[model samples]
Target: MEFAFDEADAAFRRDLVDFLDRELADGWERSEFGLGSAVHTDFSRKFVRTLAGRGWLTPHWPERYGGGGQGAWQHFVLGEEMWKRGEPRGPQYMNVNWVGPSLIKYGTEEQKRTLLPPIARGEVFWCQGFSEPEAGTDLAALRTRAVRDGDGYLLNGQKIWTSYADGADHCFLLARTGTVADGRRGISVFLLPLDTPGVEVRPIDGFVGDHSFNEVFLKDVWVPRSRLLGEENKGWDIVRRTLAYERVGAPRYARAALVLDGLADWSRTRGLLHDPGVQEQFGEARALCEAARLLVYRVIDERAKDKEPSPRANQARAAMVQAERAVGDLALDVMGSEALAEGSRGDAQFRNSLGAGIAAGSYEVQLNLITRLILKLPKE
Candidate 1:
């Protein structure tokens, strides 16, 4: 009957909130600028180091990998608090959530020794080179090629919409190692250092915010075979699992809930709280946020128990997208023109929600996955 955090977790939450309160007292705003913006990334580099010192950056990872050796719930708790404040950890969240974990599972011992420590220490930034112009969520359609060369592979292709690429030290890149006919079976993953001889990163301006996307061109970039992750042609499995982790990685509902609270305060101040329609909107948005939170918790619970990720990740991602959209709609509907003011909660939430449906995996993709994986619906 009890659905509350246990005593220890509750206490941990209290302590973490206190720490975040002090740490972010200086008015650090991620909504005004995107997470990939120079301002945000600059602060994150300094801030994440503090978290690393506290053993919070990689608490869920193994101790040998420079983590605190905590359980998954602890990690989820960290994510929730960070997300509530627009995720001060920046791109490093990818490292802690899925990237580093992927390496842990598939990286060679040398890779782990060389890579995991820097990530756990918050000394590096990573970008994903998954989606290309030809491939979005359907990763199998990627055209980037990595041909076998003398003791390495010659990587040549371009990746679009690579977030954080401008600031990244490395990339978790996927390339085709087989013929186009091979589909998903022929792809391979590479731990690509961004400074490779033929790699070029170009910034792209987007409506979401500044520096939110980039294009990475690989012109016959030579990567030693040692940089390859897992086995060639076996990257699909890693991608699948890594994506499941990334689906619910951000604890987006936490920030959505925070925005909802701000909306409530804004409503209360404008005397709109007494309006029945406003009340209904607030109630609906709150419910959606809570639903997302619970769904994400279910996924985290499975992780805590060491269960293989399932369709629940898709369900959770769908709920989060719904929650984000609902809160954004509520902000605009309730606050009207005031919500459109730059850097306001409404403005930020609306802009952020627009991307929520598209990021990670699109909301429609999650629905398709749910139909096939959870509901067992036949695809026509």
Candidate 2:
């Protein structure tokens, strides 16, 4: 349980820092929840390809898959440096995070052959389709349906709040293949080309949504049975497992840590850091951030040892309340009057922290898991 990085990891961190220095010196996102949208311009896409060429884009994956084949610590350190630099993470996220892993784990050998290399090369863009209009938190309650047809399945219904749908080339999806009465029991996971005939993506606009999501409709869009992941009706199991890995998303704790650092720096410059009241607030936030870092490390270690995070993962989510809220509150403290600015850089961090609370999983549910599920408390 020594929290210190061993020599090997220390060297790996140096390698990561050097790589970041070379690649992101031009500019990039540095936090896990790094602020702002991608330029998504041609220049940006080519810049991502340059990362691919350097073997830095998918560093978490094995080398055979066009990655650096590095360990989690190296990946974590690389992310820390990138977000701290205020640069966008680029397409590396969808590839190295969970999209490619899920496909590699559950896809057919042919499917893997077709999908993985392209994703690793930054040739394709992907988005997730787990949450439906009615089935976000209770994923099993999803109402999107898929029915067997001639050579494939006819997909119908809609997916809401799907991130990056407007730009996605494909989506890793969950659909109801059976009766709603079957609930989580009847759902299955599938992959779809977003431009498949009969499919429509409608941009969802709101004053505050930041355009990260969309409403997607599938009007008999067909997917070949070759696209079904794992066994039918057993996708619930895969979904659950996949999501555990997915939850990391390069570790919210790491990026949120940056926001906290920014707040501390601002406070010190403002002389608020010397006040007892402000110091207490900073100390509490710092404690939670440290706790989150340890909790995440435990989850990684457990996975490396081939165990379910289970209660530990639950604990990580619970601790996220402290981290995410503290970042949001930290933003208020940092920007003060500027926290309300929609276009200011500091205000952008505030908005992003506000979004972080609801993204991945809402903090409210995490609190319930900690108090009710983990502590074994009776429901109110």
- Please identify model 2 stretches exceeding 4 Å from their true place: 25-44, 342-345, 371-373, 378-380
Can you give the lDDT of residue 256 in candidate 1? 90
For all the candidates, what are their Cα RMSDs to the real structure?
1.2, 2.9
After superposition, candidate 1 runs with Cα above 4 Å error:
none
**Candidate 2 backbone clash number:** 8
What's the TM-score of each model vs. the native? 0.98, 0.89
Tens-place lDDT per residue, model 2, 1-380, is: 47788887788678767766765534234222233254432334675677677776677777766667777666666555654555345434655577787776677888888888887777777878877767777787888899999878999989887777788788888998889999888999888988899989887764553466788999988899999988887788777777666555546666667777767887778788888878888778788878987887777777666576465666776576567678778677656787666554456555556666666666676677678767899987
Every candidate's lDDT = 0.91, 0.71
| Candidate topping TM-score | 1
Pull out the clashing pairs in model 2: 28-87, 28-88, 29-87, 29-88, 30-82, 30-83, 30-84, 31-83
Residue 118 local lDDT, model 2: 81
